[model samples]
Target chain A: MSHAIETIDLKKNYGSHAAIRGLSITVEPGTVFGLIGPNGAGKTTTLRMLLDVIRPSSGVARVLGETPQAGGPALRRRIGFVPGELRLEGRIRGRALLRHYAEISGQVAPGAVDDLADRLGVDLNREVRKLSKGNKQKLGLIQAFMHRPELLVLDEPTSGLDPLVQREFLTMVREARANGQTILLSSHVLSEIQQTADQVAVLSDGLIVAEGDVAALRLGRIRRVRASFTGIAAAALRQELDHLPTLRDIDIDVTGTEPVRLTATIDGDIDPLVKLLARHSVLDLAVEEPDLEESVLQLYGSSANGRNGEVRHG
Target chain B: MVRVLPVFRRSLGDSWRSLIGWSVGVAAALLLYLPLFPSIGGDGEMQQIIESMPPELVKTLGYEQIASGPGYTQGTFFGLIGFLLLVIAATAWGSAAIAGAEESGQLELTLAHGVSRSQYALESALAVLVKLLWLGLLAAALILALNEPSELDVTVLNVLGASKALVGLAFVSASLALLVGAATGRRSLATAAGAGIAVLGYVFNAIANQVADADWLRALSPYSWAYHEMPLSDGPDWAGLALLWGLGAVFAAAATLLLRRRDIIG
Candidate 1:
């Protein structure tokens, strides 16, 4: 498949401070690509470069097989973008704002804006200043999707959106992907991207720490497993848990309890722990993915010394 | 060829209320000041009161021709109050065209919709020009309607000429603001550039009229180019008109070039 977006060693520097450093990546056409990063990790900067709103200090970026800056308005016409910081003119009603954008793009159908507004539950008659944050976000989303462009570049698309509206947004993204449109979704929230992105790139401190298929990346990380024993003593379970090679940071709570509970984090392999559990009369067992916040923190802490080289391919 | 019509249309829609407000203000100022000219010009006592004042103050205020209908109207309204009103309107429009939009994050959104930077800047300048023209025409119509009743003795042609000079003078300040706003994307800097041009021009003209050695300063002041010959009585100064329009065009062209090269910050 041809690439939808490609950047070769893209760099942006604000005087002496480097915002994005030697970044290179390729996104396949018709795939939902997630740019996952923490705040100030240069996600918005990268998106702005692709849109030609800001020029790169070095390297190059191509959208839809053309240089962003050289392609000019024609290139921009094929891409829909939602900026992270969305500020609308307070005097304009929401409908008028969408109409203006629609007229400029010249691609949105007559009723597309109204249809999207209905789906998103946004009232188009209200002035922008009167709309709440969530409502304003809905307006932004409607404009981005109304044009039905070849590519959509969204930066923190779900910020300030309620969970229900966020779900609707994800569904819209899925529909766009199904329609053969490529999407570049940038977000600090892991789950937001994890739900819709087929491929993910994790950026930390201006460097890509890990990148691959979402499922594969999840599998590579550690998981927390908690188990409670009914017919066994806590001491007996602890002794068995020590023998398991896969378990780490193992903790046991045996304080005057009829049921013994043990919690441990495991990585690499879980078969040894499974066999140990099978030997005990386990009453309840829970295996949970690590919290996204904690996982990001751990990733940053661990990669401080040995930054993972950019994972370019899936 | 990028289409900037959508941007232009939206700008007009956004500013129509302010445009009407400015038009009403100019009309009121004209009605209030033009009718008073007959009373002041016909009364010999008022002329003597003016003659008794300091010669320097009369020269500075451009009141030498206060005894005639044309002179009285020009001194009271066109040269003083009307000039202030038009410049205020133009300055606000010019500063808001680029820098205000950028600060509000609307420029980024508009450009994302396939509008080229140069096209956006050019269209914004055109919108400001159109608004300025609207105010000028309204002022001219009101002046012409009240000409006979107020006994100002100024013809319709002369009223239009005076309006042209006012619009041309305001254009210089507006264009300066557009240039600064487009180049720097800072509203305060744009406002300062526009207000500075107007204030400095007025000060330079006033000082030139008061001091013999500084008479050459009038050549550098846009205010002089606007009102030096009293457009209503002497007809429009074609040379001054050329200079004002030429400066506006130059600043607008510079703004487009600079906007194309600079980065847009939200």
Candidate 2:
């Protein structure tokens, strides 16, 4: 598949610090590519470089196969971008701002801008400075998606929006994807892309540590079953299960007089264990499946994990 | 070019009513100067007083070449009007170019779009040109209506020459503002710097003209060669006019180059 956006060893420096160091990424056309990372993960820096808002210290980037710095207007004409922060002239009405952006971005289909504004529920007649954060985001959305661009680069697009609005925004994204628009979205919120992205690139400290199809990355890392049984000798059961090999490496709890809970990293094919449990009285069986939240934590290890096991992906 | 017109219209719209109000007010003020015209003639007491003053002071208010008739009056008219209006126009031009963009976030947004740095510079120059032309036509019409026909005829050619010179100087100030605006990325500083350059140019011109012995000082000001013979009083000096035009063009070119190379959001 053709790549809509590609970066080759793109690096950005601020005096002594390297914000994005030797970073490279490629987003395929017609794919909802998610760029996931914590704050200060160089996501914004990467987006800025792609848009040519800031020049790279070294390396090259191509948007739609054109150097972003040189006449990329043709490419830009077909791309939509929403920055993390939206700052505009507060005095001008939202309608005027849209008109200015529409004019600057070159030609668009007739009445398309207004239609998008209406869908986004933005009051274009209100002065921009007076609009709330969510309204501003809506306005930004209108500008970005109004032209029905082939590529959309949205940075923390859902930042200040309510859950309902965020859902609507996701629907917008889904619709864009359905229409074959390539979306390269960066967000600290994992759930934002959890249902939207086809592929995800996890960025950490300016590096992409893991990236692949979201389902593939998340597969095979789920929780194992932990079952307890009553009316059984804990030691005897442990020995029998160990001998069976299917229930090997079990941690038995023997303090209770009734039943003992055993935890194990269960592999596939549990038919034998099921047959064995039928012969004895199984009590308080609990199977805990490790969620994608924990999988991400285990991938990053402790220092980067948020709140121990309490995933705060947003 | 098509892209710049809407922006130019919107920019003017932002201050259109007020600018028109001010223009009418200025015209009325110019009418106040009409009664003083007869007294400004050679035989009047005011003219005698002007004639008696030291040549340096006389030259300061531009009274040296009254023998040329209404051309003399018309020349001072263009000069004074050009100087004052250039200041106002430069402020508008600079503030609109720099602060206006910064304030509206349009500068950031436009720069973010695939607009090349040179294109932004060119569009901005076009906006300035539009404003200059509008003000030039106003000045020309007023001068023609008020000019004395019995004395020296202020022909359309003279008006055109004088108007072109005024437009050149206005553009020079505007181009300098854009350069400063792009460099500093602040509107106020750009306005101040643009206005400062115009005032400095005027002062340098006056000092150099007063000290005729100091020929080197003439080179210090861009205006030194700009106001030769005064408009309508004598045929326009093509060389001086060309120099001002060339300076404006160079300033505009330099601004575009710098804007292209710098990071705008900075």
Candidate 3:
């Protein structure tokens, strides 16, 4: 299968500081690939390189099988991009700006911009400066998606958007995917990516710390498991669960001997924990994936240590 | 190849209010000044007053031969006030075309939609050129309308010649700003570069007119090429016109090349 976007050892440096260091990744056609990273993690830099807005210091990037720099405007025509920092012409009405961009691309179907605007709950007649930040973001998204390009590169697409609008925006992304459009979405929000991305790459300090299918990553990482038990003493439960290889930070609470509740986090594998739980009279159990914020913090903490070790060895 | 018409149209839309304001201002300046030429030209007392003034002051103000119709018009309007107004307009537009847009983050958004860097630079230059043309034509038309009434002996051909020179001079200034903005992506720097050129050219030409030994400086000043032959009375200076236009074109081309090779910073 042909890749929609590919970067091989892509690097961008500003003097001595490297924004992106030896980055390589690929997205298959019609798949929504998420680039999950915190601020200053080089997500914007990578997107800019792919758009050819800035040249890479070294290495190569190809979109739709063409080197983006060599492709010039022709290559850009086939891709739609929403910048993280969106600034529109304040004097022009939102619809007018959208029309101008549509005319430049020369590919949007008549009324496509209006349709997208309506779906996103944006008033196109308002001057951009008069619109709220969320409204302005909607206008930006409309322009990027109006032409229905084969690929979409969105940087922090949901920033400044309210929860409802963010959900609507994700719907648009999913709809775009259904139409066979490949998407590369970069964001610091992990849940946003988890909800939509087929595959995700976690970036830290300009390098990919982890990458895989979202479901697999969820299973492979830590999970918060809570259990409530009857006919079991809290002390016995704590003793039974002690030294279990898969669990950590174990906490047990007993309420006047009515019921015992156990809470702990499990890492790597859950099978061992499940066997331990089977030995107890479990009345209820809940297993939840770690929230995006916590997941990112953990990833960063672990990666920092790993990087420090590498630095020492080098 | 990336259709620049959209950019051109958008530029006009964004700036039409300023264009209209400038047009009105140029008309007002012309109508206010041209009608005074008849009274000013025929007044013997005023002529005596001007003649008694210091020669250096007369030369500095470009009123060395203001007793005649063509000389009065050149001294009061074309050589002084009109040139300043047009150059100011050109400089503002040129700086805004790339540098202002880049600073505001509009350039990045526009380029992400398939417009090449070269196309963006060229279209922006073209937009400034067109707006400058509109202001130039407004000045010419107003002058033509008041020509017979003001008893100014300048012909329609001469009026057009002067307007053409004004446009050429403004184009050179605008293109220099455009080039600097495109290269540096800084509006203040572009403004400084354009204003510096205009001021330097004017100072050089003014000093050259007063000091015979400094005549060589005129060759290096765009201001001299514009007003040396007194285009309103004499026909357009073809060589000077060619030089002004050639400089504009060269600067515009250089800007495009520089824009294509450099990274666009926000």
Per-model interface RMSD values are: 3.2, 3.1, 3.0
Which segments of model 1 are wrong by more than 4 Å?
A: A219-294, A300-314, B1-4
Q: Residue A76, candidate 3: how far off, in angstroms? A: 1.2
Q: Summarize candidate 1's per-residue lDDT along A1-314 as a digit string, tens digits.
A: 65899999898988898888877888999999999877877899899999888899999898899988898988888888999898875678999888888777748877888889988899999998899888888898988889899999999999999899899899999999999999999998787888999998877666676788897774335779998888887787788778877678898886948688888889757777888789878889998777654565564556533354534344
Cα error, candidate 2, residue B115 (Å): 3.2
- Whose lDDT is higher: candidate 2's or candidate 3's? 3
Stretches of candidate 3 off by over 4 Å are A218-294, A300-314, B1-4
- Cα lDDT of model 3 overall? 0.85
Q: Give the TM-score of candidate 2.
A: 0.76
Listed models, DockQ each: 0.49, 0.26, 0.46
Least well predicted 10-residue stretch by lDDT in candidate 3 chain B: B1-10
What's the lDDT for residue B26 in model 2? 46
Kindly list the per-residue Cα lDDT of model 2 for residues B160-227, writing each as its tens digit. 77777777777778888888777767888878877877778777777766877765665666565556
- CAPRI rating of model 3: acceptable
Instruction: Please count the clashing residue pairs in each candidate, in the order shown.
Output: 0, 3, 0
The Cα error of candidate 2 at residue A18, in Å, is: 2.6
Error of 2 at B12 (Å): 5.1
Candidate 3 residue-wise lDDT, A77-123, digit = tens = 89899997987756889878887888767489878988998888999
